[model samples]
Target chain A: MIEFRHVSKIYGKVKALDDVTFTVGAGSVTGFLGPNGAGKSTALRILVGLARPSSGSATVLGLPYAETACPGLRVGTLLDAGAQHPGRTGREVLTLGAMTLGLPRTRVGEVLDLVGLTERESRRTFGGYSLGMRQRLGIAHALLGAPEVLVLDEPANGLDPQGIRWMRRLLRDLAEAGCAVLLSSHLLHEVEQVADHIVMIGRGRVLAQGTADELSRGRGLEETFLELTAHTDRSPGATASPGAGAGRGSA
Target chain B: MTRAGHHLNDIAGAAPSPITKDEKMNADTPIPFRRLLAVEARKLVDTRSGKIIAVVMVALVVASVVARGAVVGPKLQTLVGTAGIALGTLLPVLGILTVTGEWAHRTALTTFVLEPRRHRVLAAKCLPPLLAAVALSLFAIVVAVPATAVVSEVRNMAANWEVQPLGLLGWTGGNVLVAAAGLALGALLLNAPAAIVINFSTPVLWAVVGRLGSAGAALAEWLDLNTTATPLMRGDMTWSEGARLAASVVFWIVIPMAAGLVRVLREEVT
Candidate 1:
């Protein structure tokens, strides 16, 4: 499981995250929704120990992510698909990750097939891959460890309709297999279709969080999300009150 | 509880329970150091840039021996001198690439993510370049042996079989030192082009300054890496000369590398 408690991140004078808090648990798919510049990436980066939080805590399995020892075996993260060495073949990239996790090389081929990357696709260097191919490779990288927790930010950005459909099923299956899955996306429909739980943040504050039925209120997911986050797009700092997210985070 | 109130319980409640001692111990086992070194080595030979630099280094070693053999009618050690310069100058660039490539290509995210302890990663990067320097030195000997015999055969000159084992070893050591200096500069300035420009230019610019006067010569004696390394490479240095060599290496190699390590360790991955 992953948890962020009253977390805040300040870059110079800018408060990227403002007293934000949430948790992701086993057997659940949580959609992390926020507008651009709303600290979604910062929060995810902190959760994975890629960035440090100015105050409060981000932990995996009850310890700091950096201190978790075998982190790859406990949690998997995909912050960006373009962060890999472009000259390395897709197969070599997965092999590196698998080796880091101490898994056998055969697992590399299995993950390649699972992500729908054909033998031919895996042979090419990442520089030649289209955005869709990069996304698949990134997914394959995340799944290489088969950890109980998964964190992915904007993972479906460049995928086709068919690819997106495949991803939705894959994530759902992983969650059903008792993994905690947290993903952030601009695709509300995709989130609505797959998310068992939803956590919405606006201007670095938790606007709302709950089960789909509870958040929808019989009205629908899109209307509730836009209505809550509309004020944030206008001015991020105006809503960054100290106690702003307390009620939502508590829930 | 109200729906919002109950949901807050999930947030507060999901804080991971305390891990057992066994679990903590399990988590403590980091990836082995040997594996990290192996990965760093593979990265050196796996890319187009790495491969190109390697080919250029090999060609430089061979070309120098051939030129000296034909023109100077060289002995073994004389042939070794030309090979040393060619290898010494170029291998440092390869060493620089090993550290700065991850930063330039933004592959640090993947590398650091897999091995969060930055020091281990840096040490791993230093490993392959040092080995390359040693291997290049050996290749120089391989090329020189044949070139020496060919020069003697073609020109009807005596093949000077006289060899100084220590001088040859010292020359190889000089190349290894320069390779390390390159890595230090690369780590200190985590950009490939910037590190490359600075690493190559420092010695040349210092040489020009060293020609000015007595004060300039004094400064060069203590700090100019190329000048200090020359006598050391020939294995003809006195005790005082060895001290000067040590002093130069301290400034060029040790200090920059120490600072570079501190910066790399503290840098945020984002």
Candidate 2:
């Protein structure tokens, strides 16, 4: 299980997340919805222990991630598709992940096959892959440890229809097998199709949370999402919260 | 597997094979520190840039030896010292890359996410290049062997087979020390270009600035790394000289490394 209990992340004077609390229970999928600067990425990064929430704890399986023993065994994260070194082969990337997770080396090929990357593609350097391929490799790394919780950010952003379908099945299967899966996405339709629960946030605060049917209220998810986020930020296009792009690089 | 869907009616639709117990979580063990070291070592030669650095390091060491052998007639001390200078400069670059490469390539997120304890990760990052530097030190001496022989045969130079173990240890130790300093610099800076720039420029800049007057000389005596390290090559420092060397290393390497560890632990990875 994954949880954020009264979490707030502040960068300088700006609050990226404000007292946000949510739970992603095992055997289910939770879709996190937010605007560009709404702190979806910030939340995911905190849950995975890449970024510490300034005022609260993000816990996995009841322990704060940093304090958890063998965190990789309980949590898998794909926060950045471009985070793998471009010069390393796809297999090497997964191998390093496997090594860190204390999994058997053979798990490398298993993940590559699970993600539908051919042998050649797996052997090729990551720099040669397209964005879609990188996303797939990122997913493969996330699955390397067979973690109990999967935290992914925009995982299907660059996938083809077939790849997306495969991802849907994989996520559903994992959740069915009692894994907790939380995803943050800009693809509203895909989130609608795959998420068992939905949490919508605006300006670092949760605006609404429930199932898609609950948030819909007879209007489609896209329309409702637009209406909810339309006036959330007063400045209209203020996407640069201090920590907005920090998930990719450090100061 | 009895799959769950959004609708209650879909729960009993069909079944597939379950994910086996072995495929479930392996939560009993965290990756060992030695394993982390091994993985970091593997990374040093895994990428194109790492390969280039390794190759370039070796080539430079050999070229330095060849230049000494061809010009100064391959005296063992001169040859080893030349290799030490060349390898000393390049090995630190490798060490810096070992830490900064993670941030430069944006791979720090994946790495830290997998192993969240930042200290263990940093410790692991320090091992590989230092180990390689030791190996490279031995390689340079070995290569100097053949060069010394060739020089004795052609240039009528006496082959100084009398080797001082303490001096050899000092040279190897000195090289490893510089590389660790590079690693600390990398961890402190986190940015590759910035870390590298500071790593190369700090000594040269201090060397120039440390020669202006008595005050500058005193500062250099206690704070200049290049001078403090000379006693290490000779392995014959007095207690006062040793204290001075310790002070310089603390100011340069230890402080940056401790600060960098904190920054790596606290800095947000986006």
| TM-scores for every predicted model | 0.89, 0.92
Could you tell me which 10 consecutive residues in candidate 1 chain A have the lowest summed lDDT? Answer: A242-251
Q: In model 1, how large is the Cα lDDT of residue B257?
A: 95
Clashing residue pairs in all predictions, respectively, total 4, 4
The residue-by-residue lDDT of candidate 2 on B1-270, one tens digit each, is 532433211221111112224534346566689878878888889999888988989999999998888988758878888998897788778888888988888888888887888899888988888889899999999998898888888888788766677888888888888888888888899988988888788878788778879888788889877788788877776789889889988987899899999999888887
* RMSD to native, candidate 2: 5.1
Model number with the top DockQ:
2
Q: List the residue pairs that clash in candidate 2.
A: A246-B270, A247-B270, A248-B270, B1-B16
Docking quality tier of model 1: acceptable
Give the per-residue lDDT digits (tens) of candidate 1, residues A26-142.
988999987666788889888877788899998887888878777875677788898877888999888887766666677777678777899999999989999999999988887
Summarize candidate 2's per-residue lDDT along A1-251 as a digit string, tens digits. Answer: 88899999999999989999999999999988766678899988888888888898889999888777677767888998987788899999988877776667777777777787899999899989998999999988887666778999989888999988978877887787788999997567778889999998888998889999989989767666766666664453533432332222111
User: Candidate 1, chain A: TM-score?
Assistant: 0.91
DockQ of each: 0.24, 0.44
* Index of the highest-TM-score prediction: 2
